[model samples]
Target: MKIVSEKLAQDQFTQLKLKNLKTILAESIAQADRGELHNINDVFASLTKDKHEDISNSNI
Candidate 1:
């Protein structure tokens, strides 16, 4: 009986932690969206730069 209570308490704590983590993640995503993060554009530009460099090297 005591062990069962302990397990339940642990489960509740874990659930609470997960809920907090989810809230934090949601807030982070909202902030990123508000900031208009350009990670994708940056990645595309970097890939294009690399391709250009490759082409230049090949020509040389």
Candidate 2:
């Protein structure tokens, strides 16, 4: 995921919308701490699937 992290660092969407990696990681950790951990792995796997069908679906 090094390439993905590099892409995110240079991504215009991330720059305009979010500030930096620390901010994003903090928010994600907070959400995960709030009882949102159960499906995190499964959800991530589903979303990052080759076809990425989960992203097109609202269930994610």
Residues 2-51 of candidate 2 have per-residue lDDT tens digits of: 99988987797657535544555566677678866566564445225624
> In each prediction, how many residue pairs overlap at the backbone (N, C-alpha, C within less than 3 A)?
0, 0
**TM-scores, in order shown?**
0.59, 0.30
Model 1 bad stretches (over 4 Å) = 36-60
Candidate 1 C-alpha lDDT tens digits along 1-60: 999999999999889867866765566567577885546554345446756986999998
Model 1 has an lDDT value of 0.70
